[model samples]
Target chain A: MDQNYSTIGRSSRTKQAIEINKVLRNTYLLLAMTLLFSGLTASISMMMNMPPMTYLISVIGGMVIAMFVLPRFAHSTAGIGIVFLITGLLGFGLGPILSMYASVPNGSNIIMLSLGGTGVIFMGLSAYVLATRKDFSFLGGFLMVGFLLVLVAAVANIFLAIPAMSLMISAVVIMLMSGFILHDTSRIIHGGETNYILATIGLYMTIFNIFISLLQILGIMGGDD
Target chain B: MDWMKIVAALALIMFIVYLFPRARHMMENSPKGSSADWMGFVVPILVIVLFVMLLVQLV
Candidate 1:
């Protein structure tokens, strides 16, 4: 009976490992596709010089799709299409902001730097979690609390309007996003997150926020000159 | 003061305040991290911060 139990345990462990690997693979594959799709949409809109109204429409459309449509289809193949649509629309919305950054002196350099920084941070932290398989799930709660405090500071900053405070908020956001990269990736590799669509959304948002935050910081620093 | 900005900020604050309790609950229930776990988390974050600073400097 003990030998039978041991065999069963090993088999279950193997099965669980297989499931985790499958989820991780699907999540990364979907993530890469979504990122590229969004980049393409953003580039097209930026090159076309779309108006602010168009950006506003795309953002609202993306949010509406995300809030209402994605949940219903999250379990189906249609979920992938929804993910791409949401990302593509939001990417289109980014055109104006990217242009705003690009207009500043050395703005193009700042944008490229932020993009590179975002890539390095995402790839490094993701690799750390994927290689070590360390469960950073313990960070789930701390990260949530930190986000709240950061939100509070961000809201307060409107009244403050201090450049330093704004810089801090951007830096904190980048840090929070880095933490999320670990937490989200940890969930995928530890069986806490099973659905590839939801997993892709979580990581994509983290990367998006990191890129934006980096841009804000770089914009401020470079603009100061 | 832009009242519109104020209203938007207030709405955002309200939304986040609404999320606070759930975060609190999670904080109480989730597994606590040890020193090593925290170190594992912080070291990479440090690297990111430094790398970002270097990028800023280079530009």
Candidate 2:
């Protein structure tokens, strides 16, 4: 009787693990699709010749709305609303990329190069986390500090229009977003986040920021306007 | 190739990912399940199709 009960317990645990794995897999797949959609939207917007000033204003508005609304309402729609809002925000954020690409020669090539670089960094950092299985939760606070500093620098640079400051911000963003990928993935593996939608969104934001920053760096380095 | 098609496809992908887990769990727990039990198949296919279409458009 005890043996039968033990077998049942083990099977139940196995079933739970499988369910968690399914959630993780689904989240990664969805994240990939979101990135693709964001890319396509950006490309299309550029092709359509949207004004950069309007795009910048929309991005700012989107960020404000997302920050205020998402956390308050995320659980209401079983997280579906947050997912939709993220997708829309990402699409809108891609506007600057589209505008920059249109303004520069060899824009598509730069975009692709940036995409490839982002993929490489993501894969490398993710593999390091997975192989080591080290908890990076400690980095969370540090990452937040870095993010705030970058935000301040970015706002200041807007008025200064200093090229060196832009490069510094882009470099810092690349590093910060990489740290985020490590921290976010560790959360998923450790079961810190059970909801795959939330997990995917976190990971997707990290990837998006990394790609955008890398593209900016490339533009500054090699772009011919 | 057009923006509308891309947007529509993305929306469909979002819907599928949103629905798949519940659908899968429901099917697994249902007694009268048919060959349609493999509903999860649609999610990955939609993802792949959209991915391919995006790449093609990019090129």
Candidate 3:
């Protein structure tokens, strides 16, 4: 009787692990495709002279729809379709910055630097969480508060029109997003997030913020002829 | 910076964040059916398609 019970427990555990792995695999594949799509969309938008503001609004709209409506109604093959929709929207949203950078003489260099810098920060933060194995979930609340504060300051700065303030906001964004990456990654490893799509979205947003902020900083400091 | 676009993005992000917890709850309560499983691909594909279409039109 004991042996039979142990065997059943082991099987269940294996099943759970398999499910988790499947989710992870799908998340990674989707992430890769999203990145590729973003690149292609940005390139095309630049070629076509799409207005940056229009692209930005579309991205914002799509993000809201994806996060709210899609998740609610998407319970079938349609759910998968929603995922792609979100990814593509993100790509479109990214088009403006990509195009703007491309117009600069050294835009490509700046982009590569931003990408590399974002990658390094992500890997570093991820490594820290993995090595420590300590739950960083506690940081979530703090990060949210910090992010909001930054947002407010950013808005105020627009009216204030202070270059120094802009730089400070960018710095804060980089730090906060780095923290988010660490927290989100830790949540995944600790099984706090069993749904990998959600997990991927969270991580992707963190990385995006980091890259955008870093690019802004670079542009401010070294974007002259 | 266009304030309209910025505000729209901020509003959308806030709305999504507000909905996140509910979405998770729904996912948890729903039966693990194949239909639910298939929805996983829908969002990502839609994202790609919309982006591609937009890109083509823009280019």
TM-score for candidate 1, please give it. Answer: 0.90
Best model number under DockQ: 1
Compare candidates 1 and 2 on DockQ and give the better one. Answer: 1
Q: Which stretches of candidate 1 lie above 4 Å from their native place?
A: A52-64, B1-11, B14-18
**TM-score against native, each model:** 0.90, 0.70, 0.74
Q: Write the per-residue lDDT of candidate 2 for residues A1-225, one digit (tens) a residue.
A: 999999999999888778767767877887877777767776666666766554554454445445556667656554565666566666765876557775678677767876776786677767766787656655555566567667656655655779888878887787778777877877776666677777777777777777777667667666442
Q: What is the C-alpha lDDT profile of model 2 across B4-48, one tens digit per residue? A: 334433433443454455445544543342334223222323443
Candidate 3 residue-wise lDDT, A153-203, digit = tens: 765775687887887898778777876776677667666777766766677
Give each candidate's fraction of reference contacts reproduced: 0.68, 0.00, 0.00
- Tell me each candidate's i-RMS in Å: 2.1, 17.0, 12.5
- For model 1, the chain A TM-score is 0.91
Candidate DockQ values, in order, are 0.60, 0.02, 0.04
CA lDDT, candidate 1, residue A18: 95
Clashes counted in candidate 3 amount to 30
Model 1 lDDT at residue A196: 93
Candidate 2, fnat value?
0.00
Reference-based lDDT, residue B5, model 2: 37
